[model samples]
Target: MFKDRFEAGERLAERLEKMGPFEKPIVLALPRGGVPVAYRVAKRLHAPLDVIIVRKLGAPFNEEFAIGALVEGEPERIVLNEEAVYRLGVGKEYLDRVVAKEREELHRRQKMYRGEENPIEHLSGRTVILIDDGIATGYTMKAALAAIREQHPAQIVVAVPVAPPDTLSEMERLADEVVVLETPEPFWAVGAHYERFDQTSDEEVIDLLKKGKERTEE
Candidate 1:
């Protein structure tokens, strides 16, 4: 178990550095939980940090169980777990509502945190390291990978502090490289791996992004 997001990030940075000489690398973090962790990685890697906003589309009955994810991209992106949607018998109406709600939040977050940075277009021909605190269902990560892939990045790396074994297996195929600190079997939840897992607020995320931008400039 990790002490906190900072500790986990520091450790993750160590692992990332060993995979050194990352060419024209840029770090894209999945906020708000990912900001702090990705902040550390960006600082250590000496790379510019940006946010990749994604929202999980949960099942109709149980919102915790993700059926798909909505990712904000140039044309926007949606990745669905066909099995989950078919099994749950989700309809177009429900999916449309969820997508609309998530898109609104994604746009709001982009404006509030990014302030017109326009980092997505720069992904082409650059190595992109996508970081998150951890993975549960992996729907969000999958969506993020798909969206980033569309931008034609030189390579895609998925880095996380902890994730289940099965999720890591799936990511191996999606990402050019995968860095995970822990893959605890019978994983309970992402928060369970951290001793001090607290909710990261929008204010915190914005502050970190600003700091990351400054660090990159220096």
Candidate 2:
């Protein structure tokens, strides 16, 4: 188990470095929880670090149960769990409402984390290593992949500290390469694998992004 997000990032970075010589690499993190982890990897790779904001689309009554994921863009991208929506008998109106709410939160995050800077626009031919604290249901990462694909990246590498075996397999199919440090059996929540799994604050994200930009300039 990782002592904290920083330790997890260090271990993950080590494994990725061994894979070696990524071409025109850029690290894009799913922010809030992902920034700290991605910062270490970006520092090690000497790659530009940026956040790709993606939000979970929760079920009508159960917010923790994700029915889909939404990512912002010219025309926002969404990935839904069709089976769940069908089984739950969710209607278009409800879906639209939930998406609107989540979209608001996504914009809030983008503004808080990035301020005046524009979203990174030069991903067309670069290798994108996507990082997060860990994977649970895999929907969020799936949506992230779909959004990144729109940018026509040379490669999308999903690197995380831990994930369920099944989810890891699914990621392998979607990303060009998958780098995971652990796939624990009977997997529990992502925080369960870490000793200090505190919630990452918005201020922390802003500071990390500032540091990342400075490093790139250096």
Query: Cα RMSD for candidate 2?
Result: 1.1
TM-score of each: 0.97, 0.97
- Per-residue lDDT tens digits for candidate 2, residues 39-139, read 99999999889999999999988998989999867677899999999999999999999999999999898888886454546788889999999999999
Candidate 2: global Cα-lDDT?
Answer: 0.91
* Superposed Cα deviation of residue 43, candidate 2 (Å): 0.8
Clashing residue pairs in candidate 1 (N, C-alpha, C atoms within 3 angstroms)? none
- 55-98 in candidate 1: lDDT tens per residue? 98988989889999998877888999999999889999999998
Per-model C-alpha lDDT, please? 0.92, 0.91
Q: What is the Å distance of residue 185 in model 1 from its true position?
A: 0.7
The regions of model 1 sitting more than 4 angstroms off are none
TM-score of candidate 2 to 2 decimals: 0.97
